[model samples]
Target: MTQAIDRVRQALLQAGHPDTIAMFAEGTHTAAEAAASVGCSIAQIAKSIIFRSGETPILVVASGVNRIDRAKVGAALGRKVERADPAWVEATTGFAVGGVAPVGHLAPALILIDEDLLALDPVWAAAGSPSHAFRTTPADLVRVTGGSVANVKA
Candidate 1:
């Protein structure tokens, strides 16, 4: 496994999550690709989106089928947020944009989870590499990341 994937695995284990990481040769770079690879609905993919509020990185774990409402997020945080650049995402999360995981970020971040994801029993998230992913529940995600569930869907 790559160093990024290893860090994610270690973070999951330290958080008491029991799921195993799965690597796909074809890659899980997009939500559609990940759902197809995992044999799940598009909404079951919990995509981690990173945004920037000034110098701070904010993580929004949204359902695959839903678009995050930046206005809502900004309102919740009382700060305006913009899409983070690719390099900033990598620097902030210690993973590439397409492979940013909910946990194991390199820098401190305020994490927010989409409320829609909570309705799904099992969800898939990126595992620090474009080819890696893991299964998890929304509640478990919140637990591991210490994130708040909100209406992030647009």
Candidate 2:
């Protein structure tokens, strides 16, 4: 398990992202759990959510502080945004739903970032493991994940 995490970290580095990844014994399956483990506000955690915009998969890195504004998302993209099922998440990301990272996925997705994350300097994100997470700036995440800054949240 540690070796797998190391690989994920290496992938992040190879992708030109800062290597500030951290692992923990407790699972970061939820924002509250991650906030407790990382000792940060729950709002600082970025939830890597996969939603289906028609047949295409769009990845939304939303702030833990707010939920996605489905109507706004639909309006911006011109398609209805339906929350992707767990199976779809696994299929698209190669990682489980709760542990999905913004990068190193099995398939590329249309990425939209929560503009609110910009207010938080160092944002916590999943690290390809349920028990691991990392802190990095939202701008760096956008660059590393090839995501665009957008008003993805309500």
Whole-model Cα lDDT of every candidate shown, in order: 0.91, 0.82
Error of 1 at 50 (Å): 0.3
Best candidate per lDDT, number?
Answer: 1
Tens-digit per-residue lDDT, 49-96, candidate 2: 888876678888988878888777777777788888999888766778
User: Per-prediction TM-score, please?
Assistant: 0.96, 0.89
Q: Write the per-residue lDDT of candidate 1 for residues 24-75, one digit (tens) a residue.
A: 8878899999999888999999999999998899999999999999999998
**TM-score between model 1 and native:** 0.96
The list of candidate 1 runs beyond 4 A from truth reads: none
Q: How good is model 2 by TM-score? A: 0.89
Best by TM-score: 1
Instruction: RMSD for all candidates, in order, please.
Output: 1.1, 2.0
